[model samples]
Target: MISGLLLLVLVGSAMAQRDLSVDCGSDGWVTVHWRPGLGFSQTLDQSKALLGTCPPSSLMSEDTLLFRVLVRDCGFIQQVMEGRVTYSNMLIYARRPELPIITQLVKCDYDSPVGEESEFSAEEPDENREQETFNMEIMNPDFSGPAPSLRFGLGSSIPIRATVEPRSHRSLRIYMKSCEFATDADIRRATQVHPIIANAGCLMESKSGNSSFLPRRHSDEMRLYLEAFRFALGQKIFLHCDLEACVVRSLNVDRKACHYVPEKRRWTLLDEPSQSYACACCDSTCPRTGLMIDGVSVHKVLGPLVIVENEPESSGSPDSRASSAHGMSASRVWLLVFVVALALVTVMGVLVISYYLCFWRGGRLGYRPSRDLLTKY
Candidate 1:
C-alpha cells in the first residue's frame, strides 16, 4: 500500500508540470519550450494554448494542450509546421516514460504605411459683399495609402476641412472659385474653389462633411466666398487644417485642351473637353484669324467678330461653288441608281415568266384538248 501511494504522488507531480512557454520576435520568429510529457500528449486540446501569461485552464486526459504558432509579415500570415506528440503511445521510451516532443518555426510579411507632404497657394474675389480681396496661408498636405502624388485623374474628389485665422474684422469666408486661361484667339476656362474670408476668429470651424463642391464654368470670375473672404489666381490661398479633417480630405480634378482652325467653321472637341481647346471664333464667322494656345483662342482686334449675327458670305470662290455642287450631285446619283435598279428587276421578272409560259406548253410538248372540243361543237 505504501508503494502504491508513492506511485500516485509521482503521477500527480508529472501532471503539475503540464505547462508550455513561447517567445515571439519581431523578425517573424517564434520559439516554444515545453515539458516532454504534456507537450507530446495526443489527448491535448488542439485549439487551446498552454503557454505565456494566460495558460490553458485544463489539459487533455493525457496531460496536453493543443497549441499552434503563426507568423505575420508583409501582409501575410501562414503556419509553417504542425503535428501531434505522444508519450509511450507515440514514442518508445528507453527508460524514462516521457512523451516525444515537437516544435515549429514560421515566417511572414505585412504592409507598412508610407507618408508625404505638399503645399499650394491661390487667390480669388470675395463673394459675400463683392469685394476684390485675397487671403493666403501655408498648408502641409499629407497623402497615404494608394494615392498618387501628382497629376490626379478626373472624377477624383478630395474632401477638405480647415480652420482659418482672420486678419480683419470681416468674417473670413472660405470658398472655391474658377479661373480662365485664354490665348490670342481662344478662351480656355477652368473653375476651382480657393479659400474665402468671413468672420474673424481663432477657432473658426468650417464643416466640410457634406461640402462636395466642384469646379464649374465662369467659376474663375466667381470666387467661393466662404462668407466674406475670396481666393483667386495672384491672390492668397492657404490654410491650417485639423488632424481629423486631413485624414478625409481628397481632390477631384480633370484637364482638357483642343486645337482650333480659323478656316473651318466646325468646332471640334466640344464633347471631349480634355482633348479639345476653347475656340475664340464665333459660330457666326469663318475665315477670321486669331491666336490659339492651350485649347483657347484670343482675338487681337475686337470687331464685328465679337457681335452681329447672320453675316452673309462675302466671297463665292469657284472651289466653294464646286464643293456644294458635288455634294448635291452625289445625292442625286445615288437616288437615281436605286430607282433604276428596282424598275429593271421588275421588268426582267415579268418577261421571264411570260416567255416560260408561251414557249413551254403542257407536259411532253403536246397540244391541249380545249381546241379539239371546240372543233367538235
Candidate 2:
C-alpha cells in the first residue's frame, strides 16, 4: 500500500501464488505487500495453526487473511553460499488438520534487485548512506552519558536513536534484525563473537543473562540492555546490530526486537506493549527477509565498548596497612644494600682474577705485596 519497489508479486485469482511486493523503504523495514484472499476462510485446517505464522498486522485484515510477516519471523529458511544469500518460506492450506489442500512458496534473494547490477561491496551503497539518520550509544537508565565502566554495575544499555532531520511527518518504525558483540571493528575479520541478538531480533535469552530490548519511549529511539560480562585481555569490543526502518503511519510492533522476560514470565515487544502474538517466532526460527532490504537496512555499532574484568580490590586495616608500608620500605633498603655489596664483590673478583692471570704469566711481577709485607722490617 505504501509506495515500494513493486517486488516479484503477481497476485493471482484466490491468491493462487505471487511474489510479495517488496519495498526497501528509507526507514529500514522491508515492507512486503502481500496479495489478498489466501482462502483461510475456506480452509478448516486446524493444523494450519501449527504450521506457520504471520505478523499481527497482516493476518487480521477482516477475513481475507492476506498475510504479512517479517519474512524472518514466519519459518523462513535462509541459506548463504557462493556470494549469495537466499530466504525460503511457504504458506500452507490443509484439507483437514493434517491433509494438504494448497501450498504457496515464496523466496527472496538479498542480492536480487531489478537492475542487473547485483554486486556486493564492502562499502555501503550511496543511496543507503544518504538514508542513514541514526546513532548508537552507551547510556544509563535516565539516558545520561559518560558511560559507566564495563566492569562495574552489571552491564550497560545501548540506545540506538534515529532522527529524520528535516523531520519527516511519517511515523518512524525501527526494527533490529540481529546484533552481535565482536572483538574486531571489521566484522568480516572478527575473532571473538558473542551474539546477543539473533533470529531476527530475538535476544539470546539463556546465553546473555539480562540482555533484551527495553520498551521504547518515542518512535525515534530504541534501547537494549546487555548483561554483565567479563572478558579479560580484550582489545576492542564492538556491538553491531542490523536495523530496519518502516516509513509508515501506524506502529509496526509485530516484527521488532523481542525477548522473553523471566521475572514477568512473558514475551515482550521491544517497541510496543507486551501482549505479543507476532513474537511467537522469536524463540525458535523466525522468518527470513525475502526481499533485499540493504538499501534501508543499516547496521549500527557501539564500540570499542571495552568490557574488561574488574580490578583487584585492596584489603588491609589502616594500622596493618601502615605496617605493610613500613615493611616494604625496609625491604627496599635491604635490597639496595644487597645490590651495592654484590656490585663491589663483582668488581673485587674481577680485579683478583686479572691479577691471578698476570701472576701465572709473569710470576711475582703481576702481584704487588700487601702493605704489611711492604714494611721496611
Candidate 3:
C-alpha cells in the first residue's frame, strides 16, 4: 500500500501527450521538471503536467531562442496519505492568462530516514511526547511514518512497529508487555479485549501462527508484526498495547518478548536467541519487568483499522474491487438466462411430441370408430 501510494506522489516515468513533456525521473527527492514548450497544441491534454512561468526563487535561465526556465519546489499542495506525506500540485500552461491548455500533476513522496523522526511529517515533525519524555506509537511497515486508522485485509500481516523514545534514558530497553484488539480504545473491560500478546510479552498466538516480535535493531525499538484479524466481522479494531521501558543492564528472563518456536521445540526470546531458556515461562506464567528507569509504562493506542473479510482478487487497486463485483454480477445474469432458455426448449419439444402422437400417429391416444351398435342404427 505504501509503495502504491508513493507511485502517484513520485512519478517514476515520463508521459508526454505532445511536444511539451513533464518528467520527475530524477535521482532523489523527486525533482519534477519541464522542457521548452514550443510547437505545443493550444488546447493541451488536460492531464498533461504543465509548469507555468518559473518563479523568481527557482533556477531561471533565458535562452536566445525565446525560451524560459520553469521550475518549482514549494507552491504545490501538501497531502497526507495512509502513512507517508505527499506533495501534489497541478500546473496549468497557457500563453494567455485566461486560457488553460495543459495541466500537469507534480508531486513527490516524503520518506522518513531509517530511525530518525520518521514519525514526523516532511514539513512538520510531530514529536508527540507523552508521560514525561517517554513515547510510544505505531509506525508503517517501512517505519516511515505514523499509521493511523488504515485499512487492512483480514489475512494480511500488519507490521506493528512500536518504539520508545527514552530521551535521556539511553540505558533503558523497550519491551512489548501486552497487546490486543479491542472494540473500544479504552479497553477497560476484559470482555471487550481479544488478546494478541499475553503473559507479559509472550505471543500466545505464535504457537499456531506467525505473530512474533522482530529482531531488535536498537534497544529502544521493538516491532511485532501481526497476521491481521478483527474483533468482529466487518468491524474496526484498535491496538491497545502496554509497553515497558526497563532499565537495561544485562540480558535476563523477564524483560523480553517471547514466541513459541515450533522447530526449536521451545519458546524463544525475540532479541536474544541463545537466551531461549529465559522465555521458558512463556508457555504458562511469565514475570513482568522489574526495574523501571522512567517509572512510566507506555500505553499506546493505534487504530480504528478496518479488517476486511475478503480482498479484491484484482491485481491491487480499489477501483478493481468494484469492477470485479460487477463482473461477477454479469456472469450470474448470463447463467440465469441460459437456464431459462434451456427450460423453454425442453417444454417446446415435449408439446410437439404430444401433438404428433394424439393427432397424426394416434399411438397412445388412438380413437377407433366403434361399430355403429346403437347410434348409427
**Predicted structure with the largest TM-score when compared to the true one:** 2
Report residue 106 deviation for candidate 3 (angstroms). Answer: 65
lDDT of 2 by residue, 347-369 (tens): 99999998887766558555776
Worst 10 residues of 1 by lDDT: 1-10
Residue 12 deviation, candidate 1, in Å?
Answer: 78
Off by over 4 Å in 1: 1-321, 361-377
lDDT of 3 by residue, 103-218 (tens): 33445455422123312232432367434344555555555666533666666567677666655433557777788888877788534678888777788778766666778888
Error of 1 at 202 (Å): 36
- Residue 55 CA error for candidate 2 (Å)? 11
Q: Give the Å error, residue 248, model 3.
A: 1.1
Estimate candidate 1's alpha-carbon lDDT, on a 0 to 1 scale.
0.25
Estimated TM-score for each candidate: 0.18, 0.47, 0.46
Instruction: Give me the overall lDDT of model 3.
Output: 0.54
RMSD of each: 28.6, 18.9, 23.0
Candidate number that wins on TM-score, 2 or 3: 2
The CA lDDT of each predicted structure is 0.25, 0.51, 0.54
From the highest TM-score down, the ranking of the candidates is 2, 3, 1
